[model samples]
Target: MYADLWSFALSTYARPGCEAACLRLQAQGADVCLLLCGAWLEQRAVTVTAERIQALKHIARPWQTDVIEPLRRVRTQWRAMAQQDEDLAGLRERVKALELDAERQLLGRLEALAQTWPIGNAIDQLHWLEGLAAEDAANLDHDALQQLRVVVTNA
Candidate 1:
């Protein structure tokens, strides 16, 4: 296991099909950073609880809404225009990097909150993913979730 959430996320995201799966989940209204953190917690055998889920969400939601989403919106808004303009494309790339950095910061915050929590208490680690997923769980893509779980476990 990677000792930290960010390291685990970086490695897990690099695994084949992981990026696509995460993107699909994100499109379905799931918070990708939270899901990645969920994967990290699961890999570490951390027990899931309602309180713990709320704690992580508390740390993630604001930063995501205030910081990451705006960066993402700007980068996405520029996609088509950037395709035609080299300068816009370069600016878009920079925005993309900022978005990534924002996510990293969010992950760091999440780690700071959960790092002290005990691990190896859950018999079933899947709870972290399920708990952190969208409120309308029925809409979530099970295949993508499963792929993420498989990759995290394998890693």
Candidate 2:
């Protein structure tokens, strides 16, 4: 189990079905950074409380809205044009990289915020996820979320 957020994100995202699950959740307005943070916390057997979940989201929301989402929007918006324009494709690739960097920075911030939070005996694997994505969780693609939870818990 990886304790480092970035490393855990990289490895867990590379797992089969994990990327698709993440993208699905992302499209549903879930914060991927928080999802990865959830995975890391689960790896360490942290007990999730509603207050702690809100604290994590509070840290992630601003950066995601102000930084990562814009880069992602530009990158995604350029997809069709990028198919026909080499210059735009290059620019889109760079934007994609920037988006990744933005997420990395967000993860760093999340790690810092929870660095001193105590670990607990019980593992609330889905609580973190639900807290972050509660609205969509009600109508989520259950299989995909289950897949993500499996990856999150290393199950």
Candidate 3:
């Protein structure tokens, strides 16, 4: 397991099928950064609690909504136009970079918040993924969620 959340996220995301699974979850309204953090916490055997989940959401929601989402919207909006124009493509790429940096910052904040939480204390450590997932958990893609779980456990 990685010593840091960001490293863990990077490695986990690079696993085969993980990226697509993450994207699928994201499209379903789940916060990928939060899910990744939850995966890291799960790997470390951190106990999932309402307060902890709320705290993670408190930090993640605003950053994702105010910082990351706008950058993504801009980048996505420019995708087609950028494909037709080199200048727009350059600007879009920059926006994409900024979006990624913003996500990294959010991950850092999440790690700082969760780093003090003890690990290996949970009787059941499998809640992180579902707990950190979108509020509409019943509607989420179970297959994608399972894929992520398999990748994390196998790692």
Predicted structure with the largest lDDT when compared to the true one: 3
lDDT string for model 3 (1-155, tens) is 79999899999999998999999999999999999999999999999999999999999999999999999999998999999999999999899999999999999999999999998788898999999999899999989999999999999
Worst 10 residues of 1 by lDDT: 118-127
Give one digit per residue, the lDDT tens place, for model 2 in 1-155: 66678888888889888999989888877777887788777667778888888898888888988999888889989999999999999999999999999988999899988777776566545566666664557776667667888876654
TM-score of candidate 1 on Cα atoms, chains taken together? 0.96
Q: Which of candidates 1 and 2 reaches a greater lDDT?
A: 1
How many residue pairs clash in all the candidates, one count each? 0, 0, 0
Computed on alpha carbons, the lDDT of every model, listed in order, comes to 0.92, 0.80, 0.94
- Measured against the true structure, the TM-scores of the candidates, in listed sequence, are 0.96, 0.91, 0.98
Return the clash pairs for model 3, or none: none
Candidate 1 residue-wise lDDT, 1-155, digit = tens: 88888888899999998999999999998999999999999988888889999999999988988999999999999999999999999999999999999999999999999899988888877889988977788999989999999888887
- Ranking of all predicted structures according to TM-score, beginning with the best and ending with the worst: 3, 1, 2
Q: What is the lDDT of residue 110 in candidate 3?
A: 99
Using TM-score as the measure, name the better of candidate 1 and candidate 2: 1
